[model samples]
Target: MTTLTTKLIQQSDARGSALAVISDDLSLTWRELCDFSLRCSTMLRDKGIEKGDRVALLCSNRPAFLVAWFGLANIGAVTVSLNTGLVGEGLRYSVTQCSAKAVMIERAILDAKRADLEPVLEGRTVIVFDGEQDLFAVLSGLAADAPYEGLGSDPLSIIYTSGTTGLPKGVLNCHEAFLASGRWMSRYLKITEADRIMVFLPLFHTNPQMYAVMSALEVGCTLVIRPKFSVSNFFDDARRFDCTMFTYVGTVLSMLTSRIKTPDRNHKLTRCVGGGCPAEVWRAMQERFGIDPHELYGMTEVGGWVTGNSAENYRFGSCGKARPDVDVQVFDPQDNPVPAGTPGEIVVRPKAPFTILLGYWDNPKATWESSRNFWFHTGDAGTLDQDGYLYFLGRLKEIIRRGGENISPFEIETALLDHPDIADAAVVAVPDPIFGEEIKAVVVAKRDFPPQDVRHFLEGRVAQFMLPRYVQFVDEIPRTETQKIQRRQLQENDRGMIDLQGVEEHA
Candidate 1:
């Protein structure tokens, strides 16, 4: 039930001499990290940051990010981790959404986002951290003090969603929820002090925040931080850090498999974890690297693993079984639990306390809407097998209803990704006069080719009804930081497409 700050102090006291973090050539021992974090806390307190204050943290993936984050939490200030990739309204909305008092941004980020940020942070305290020197010099002349005592359920972070269509909601998460997820990750992945957890994912996301940061502290292991995911240097970085475990964002595995890099089987890396990977990519990684990429289903709201695949218990093409302490069920439109293998909205409820989010920041209506029939509706569509294995079916809103049948874009996208000539693809529903909605496929191809070829390619592979009605070629498909397709952007994009069949492929 201890908070992240308390755990940091405990790790500092017990293993002060142990290496805790490594970012490039520099490294931090437990003691130094704790001392710097304490200094950061003292400095922030002096800057008028008080308990219950929400501070926007805009920074890159570095040790300083952790220091500032822990420092803020130490003083009971909520860390509003904004996505660095967000720009304009998406960026401004995140900062002002929770009435954040200060915007602690990296100088580089501030310089780049000055236009989008300048007006919003006019009166707000804009604390900027450029690099290690700034982080180290924080509370420079002030004495280090113990962290403020707080309950495990105290708000620690407010993670905002990627608002593509609408303003992103700030997810209010507490210490226990974050740590519990970390403990589960540590145990499920079989992490130990000897294992180095490599975090190449964005720090703003749940995987790195909960799995990498919290798991490393829970097990007193070293955290190997990278600025970003690099295809060429991934294995090299792993071997250099002696990292035994690494986490991915579903797309990393695909990227690694797609690239024609030299055989990288000889590394300390073993366990790979995260979700969004197709079965082909999952198997490709296993066959090529001998590491099973465990598929774990989670999000900003749940703050923990709703379903996961591990070595002991796993199912190919499924996002594992519901976590032992979490009740994951699929419910129909009427709010009744659907039978196994029936596609419906994935709803979750924690059997254990402090595992789910406190609420969607200040949006009680959104929270209440999510908590329908005592089960938190995830808004994503999925199904549970008879054995309780969960199969993801994309977002419920993204499910296209042509005539009466609901078609999932994920399966079509996964199929499209298998095309050799096609580099990337996304499926969306277009307005149709007859069928109500028609399936449209937007593709990024290696070379120009007839759009009908795509339909011919999927002839027998997918259901006839699942074949896309329109095929559009695009220069690139926009994706989120985690590499998820930006479906909304595609829906808003004007049509420069070829209609495949003038009729729906209804049997």
Candidate 2:
């Protein structure tokens, strides 16, 4: 029955002047945070926004975004968090797709997309966070207290997916689902009120919003916010903000590991919880920073994490066992459970009601398709061991098919990453006349390593058929905001590729 407003109010009363949120130039205590959210809610209500109305927030990782989010929750309105990096048609589509009644945005963002946003802003309330029409001024004129009477089933937020494959789908999450996710993550990460967490991932993402922001709020912990992840200033920020815990994705971890070690690398960080930590980089990062790495597995549609590795029970390269409240299984194309140590699609079923996503916003077809056969199909390929640990493979669609054999790109990518010279690698499927699709590896290396050396390195490790037929060196690999590889982009940019085995070109 607990709602975000009730939880925040209770935490404010309990924690009072305790630090709640910290950014580069701004910090707020629990009481202050609650007051700001109340004012924001009042402002929204004053602008004719009613309960269940959609309010779009297009700000970066700052206090303004948090205030807007909680404000929407307080009024029982749905918060549509748009990506700050999105512009033009993408930005317009997101705002319109959700039918947002109002939009609270930074003035800088508005100015940048004034032409595109003008058409979308018609008949909607637009409040700028900066300049002459500052949103803070409106809040300052309003009272600093409001009441919330919302059910746990009330819709809280609509978080859009990365849209790598096509247009982003808005994932609708209810209050109960959001709260349950935070509670689960807090337990998984062993988060406490005394902990201070660093959150540098974009707020538009579910990882930072659900795991870092919500977990901290649920436990009355302090959240140190950064605009975005910066490898150069990560350690410094963690130390400066006295962060005891932080979350990361694989790409950020790789970038951090590639950076030269400095004397100021020491920090108060004790725990790191995130997904996509490569097995090779896990131990090296822990040894270098003295922080425990806890890998997890989940998607935006799952509400939160379905599986996670903990300090008490952790296995290298495994995403840990399925959470007790969730039924996670690997299923074949026919929806039958696969045997242990076999790769298949990962599916999940929630044991508790309202603990997973309500559905895709305004897209019943997608919702029904994902929840077919009474289970949520994740579209990811992975294997479950006899010990119940889940090992994540690449996406099912991304799996490379060679001469009548199914090949996992993740397996080959992991092998390539094990090489000392390679920093990051992505294996993609390229068109082949005979094999249908062949393997093309796009790599980012620390130094110049000949393609022949890469082939030799993979000779004894992977099967001859699984080795990439073509290799291309790039300065950087293209990735989405969430750090997932953009294999489609690599395929589109594969003009000049080095053939390792003198493979014939496809017609």
Candidate 3:
């Protein structure tokens, strides 16, 4: 009952009538969830899917997704949660990469990408949910009900995350890790069974899986699931379920603050938890919406969250203080520890068991390299203050070295986002003969915004060295489902740029 493998059954027996999850308008109690999950496990086991089997799950935020996810875990199989936004080679790459024994997809997605998924789906056991099979009845006809053998350290899921370069690597995480993170997060957020947490973020991402899905089970709370993030519906959704807390990435807040005509300052939400929240967005959330944003730093490599910001010990601009369960440090290019407040590569090692991921699936080289010097090198640029608070700069590779100065694209992007007309912004390092790397800012604005005005807006706000030499107006900015700007893609993009130096010289 300690492990997530058996927590479902325990919750069922102890809180059978307690509301477990809500999707759209339908709700399920703990008993119903346990029953449904067991059915999924039975059906899969009946189909020869035993322990260690890999199953690709490409579905949206719904009840069926949860059934398949938990069902896979119940039998000790690994669930490969594929991003629903993937198409063509990206979709095929993840399915084949994991060597998934089966694929549980929504009918809607299967129909749309059948051509791209045909090769991998040809011989695999494909279970399309959302009307394909009556899950409640699938196991009614079966159940040899022998003793279930599962371990907490057994991998519960393999989530695929793309790095700054190369193909995506599969991060193999275990039940103990998920269970531990849930408990840590519950305590970090002060979550209780009475706190109804809203999850509009995709479950494929680690935020929802660890913070929302697993946390709910850890504390026996309610989860209100929405299909996807909606700016217009956010105000009502928060109040609709009377949700006390919600999970967020910075993009969600930016969208709500910008797109919504009037920010929902009167919602019942007290706090939100997640990372990638810039200082501007963090303060804006507090002033405009009355929600205290808890921005933590995390990656799939070292479980869910390494450091957290909370009411007890909090910092406005920093990601937060290191969790009591992990040792967080910053290292220089030579992997040596730097002085406090000195920007360097963020690294971590777990203080508790199973907090770090098992390893990259089938990639020993990556596994060994990531855990170099016996520490999980996060590859992110950040610093630790003397008080032990972590300040997250952008990715190390994305830092623009201009005239011997290292400039953070994240800093420039934050300043750009503050502009009245700019809707979205991403700053990337561009090649230059003189300084080796110049700055380029790709902006998505509300209307026709000139590049000079954009440059003028940043006059005194940022240093002259950090100001972008090239500016481009685009309709939209490329982002992953988790709201991370695809910086590698942006760095590779050199099209339609307006050279500010030439424009200034001509004027």
Candidate 4:
């Protein structure tokens, strides 16, 4: 009963003239957004896109992105959200792997990667936005009405995982799950129509999409969209838009703390809802900006949040208690429940069906492997206190969390090995004060290679976040008997082996 279509319709009918979305160039009311979405949906249906078809959306955080997203959902079509930072092989692999029938991309992205996208765009519908000929022009004369026959359990979006170990897997999320997430956030965060939510994170990720965008739509609140996160203008933007609440991830809090204190820092902002709020920075933010930081723990696979710590009932280093509808427990490797305060894998079971991820798209092996024992196993190590408060310890998977982005060591190693001068490589996480973790690469090279040269080689091959911060060349890399790279050993031994500051200086 709580499908996205219903949420939009209800809001438009009730608050037709309320401001719903705001960006630098455009602002739309609830009625306008609902009407535009209907026209967009009709446009897609005219192009032969039917129920259950996959349509890829590759654009930055903008009004066009939201229009396309809602339009696809209106007609029961699945959307494959592509990260705007992706390029070349990574971009091609995502579209091809999902078997996207059509792609809607921004003109700037298309122009920059026309050569890389040519092969993937062949034999598929490609619609360009933010250009001379945009989606607005195409839907100018289209009817502002479309049939909504979607059920709550139908698939809504396919978000690709952050390829931490190998290739990225598409995580399928349903309408029911998304609606449940927004409802929970709306109640727990106490968000109301008067709240102005600032959304600076990428729209492709679940954090910004669910916590910021969807939650705003559900409550008929004004959503202030940003192209991307900006450290220098973060507080300025919030103050400029009179934002009441904002979401964050990674080192956004830490970066803000490092800035010089200003008198205008204390603005209309009152509440902060996000994960990865380090304990030190968490305290600093509240003291500096007069805002309470509510840290929570969840992932893309879980469909929404699992645990959250609010200002009223928060522990310094805890992620708070699990929701009433979710069964969250810490279990050992053998699947037995671990004692309180013991670190183990965090697993979850939703009380209602279709309130969590349906499964990984096109990867039954991963779906079955993760959801074994009737509980979806989260690849995160954490502990629950006696009071039911969750404390995140670390990642079970060998992925690096750099500034809130997941960087896969295997992906970096594979790219490093592509260089003729490098014979072997192993990537590991190094502790950092601001970013939480920075990447370090230990390589067995054929000859001496400058760190800058290696970075230049990986510029277009991988995302900017995946690039290594420190490079240490050695004669050989440690390996197991089965010829597996001993990453844990490398991580432990390299603590004092390389001068990270010197490497940065030279690079």
Q: Taking the tens digit of each residue's C-alpha lDDT, what string does model 4 give over 365-467? A: 9999999899999988888999999987556777688999866675566567567687667788888899999888887767875666667788898898888
Cα lDDT tens digits for candidate 3, 1-507: 245647777778888899999877579898888777777777888778888999999988887788778888888889999999899999999999899999988888899999999977887999876542565556567652332467777888899885646899999999888888888888888898899999988888898999888889888889898888888788788888889989987588777767654556778899999877777778878888889998899888788888998678888988888878889999998889999989999999988888879999989999999888988998899989999999989888788899899999988888898898999999998889999998999999888867888789998989988888999887888887667788878878778889998988888
Q: Candidate 1, which segments miss by more than 4 Å at Cα?
A: 502-507
Candidate 4: segments with Cα more than 4 A from true spot: 131-133, 262-264, 399-496, 499-507
- Cα deviation at 407, candidate 2, in Å, is 1.8
Error of 1 at 338 (Å): 1.1
What is the TM-score of candidate 2? 0.95
Q: Kindly give the number of clashing pairs for every candidate.
A: 0, 0, 0, 0
Alpha-carbon runs more than 4 Å astray in model 2 = 131-137, 261-265, 503-507
Q: How close is candidate 4 to the true structure, as a TM-score?
A: 0.80
What lDDT does each candidate get? 0.86, 0.85, 0.85, 0.81
RMSD of each: 2.3, 2.5, 1.8, 10.2
Using lDDT as the measure, which candidate wins? 1
Q: What's the true lDDT of residue 468 in model 3?
A: 87
lDDT for 372 in candidate 3 is 87
**Which is better, 1 or 2, measured by lDDT?**
1
The order of the candidates by lDDT, greatest first, is 1, 2, 3, 4
Note the residue pairs that clash in candidate 4.
Answer: none
